[model samples]
Target: MKKNQNFRFEKKNRTKLKIKIFSLQIMEFVTHCENSESSTTSSIIPEMETSSQIVELALSVERADTAALLGADESNIDTLEKKRLEEIRQQQISQAKLMAERRQKKAAMGMEERQNWEQEIERYRIENEEVEERQRRLDIDETMEEFYPKLCEWVGLSNYEVLYNSLEDGTNASDLNKKICGEKNVMFIIITKTGYAFGCFCHKKIPYPKKSYIYSMYDKKYFTFSLRNPSCSEPIYFKQKHKGKSICIWPNDEKNFIFTTKRFIKIKNPNGPHGTRSFFHGKFSLKYKSKDHQKREHTFFTQTTAFDVHRLVVLHWF
Candidate 1:
């Protein structure tokens, strides 16, 4: 009976130990489930809000001023950027207003300025014309002053008499008689509106200026040239051989004479010997380097004025 009682006690002790072990297992399972649920809930929720994240959200909503004031950056970078943009906008507005004001001022002054500009142009043109006319007179004065001094040098006269000067008397002999024409043994130099001159000695007292060739005294021709005729070649007389003009006392004083037909006793080209000779007359070509000597003579008939002369000892232009 005691052995059976010991066996029953051992079985009861074993049953108690199994019950405690089962309770421990159940407690552990519940704790693990609670921990997992708590971790999952924590993961679903969010962390506490930071200052930079709040600033970013505010700026995204176009509230930069609020973001900048409440920011932890402490730099006020947004405020500085706003001020710079405002300044640029103000500058553009001010420039547009200034340009409008300038346009209005120019429109108001246009008519008065146009009138003044026209007046200024007219005055300038008149002043320019006056300057030109003054220059022309000065040129004529210079030419007149030059001709007389050069005449004295060319004539090389030791003693001479000025019996008449057309400038003092008159240039035209057509109105006056032969009394105005100087006496025999007198010489003459005619100054005309044309640039060149005409000069000769009167062998006898001529009645009319047009018929003075019959009384012509001078044998040599005189003219001005830039280049000297240095070649010592003989002269060719084309008019004498071709046109029956030999030993001519040219009607140089006659204004009505034909221009091309008028001839002078002179060699044309005395530079060098070449094939360039006058027609019908070789070894002599009546070349004219300067102005035509007969052209100056024609002026004596109509416009022969302002002339003076001296007796030539022996006139030969060499």
Candidate 2:
């Protein structure tokens, strides 16, 4: 009986211990669930805040776009498009009209008539070109008559040929040398813009070896002359006073032709934008006897000390 009583008491105690362990497990599970819930809430709060910020930004952008749309001028865009289209339409119409006119003109003419018309146009073009060429040749002939014969006579060169004209060849030094370097006699004729004309005669080959800023002192045949002078009635000849200096052929931006040096007669910038600048001095001209038995005052060809050139012509003969 005592054993049965003790067994029943132990069984009751075992049931009580099992109930206490189950209660403790339940409490622990509830605490774990609460912690999980709290953690989830904490994690979600920042996400929710970010989403709200994004929503606010989207709303602001939408409002700004809406304001821009409202403020924009639809009429301006429509007007610009219409104007562009109208211009295109007008251009197309004009082109169509031109094409139709051309076709109608073509159709109106017979094949023979078209050939005749083309021939007539060609004749006119040829005649025009011929006329221009004749006029140019006439002008050159006049210049030749005025200076060519006289220059040849003075230089004692009968058999000669035209070498280089600036209007035809070019105003380059290399080109000048190519045309007139080997020749024994060369004459330079320069006409100024102001209608004054002058030139240099080099008996020696051009670009004479004896270059002098003062005087060449060796070349007796080298001389300068004024063809057309406003002050002088006749074409005045300038004998080289400082012992017949050889004419200098200046090159590459120095001077086109240098007749004398130290009170020099020269032309600068032959083909430049400002045209050619010519310098003439009183000492260049030879002194003449006056009627009053007195020394005539020195005079230059251009009247003025300097003038701009109009044309430069170079002729040579072997």
TM-score of 1: 0.30
Tens digit per residue, CA lDDT, model 1, 169-226: 3322332223334343343332222223333333344333444443333324322211
Off by over 4 Å in 1: 1-144, 147-149, 158-173, 176-180, 184-213, 217-318
Q: Over the stretch 111-171, how does candidate 2's per-residue lDDT look in tens digits?
A: 6698899999999999999877445433545666766677667888766667877677766
Predicted structure with the largest TM-score when compared to the true one = 2
lDDT winner? 2
List lDDT for all candidates, in order. 0.38, 0.61
State residue 174's C-alpha deviation in candidate 1, in Å. 2.2
Q: Relative to the unseen true structure, what is the Cα RMSD of model 1?
A: 20.4
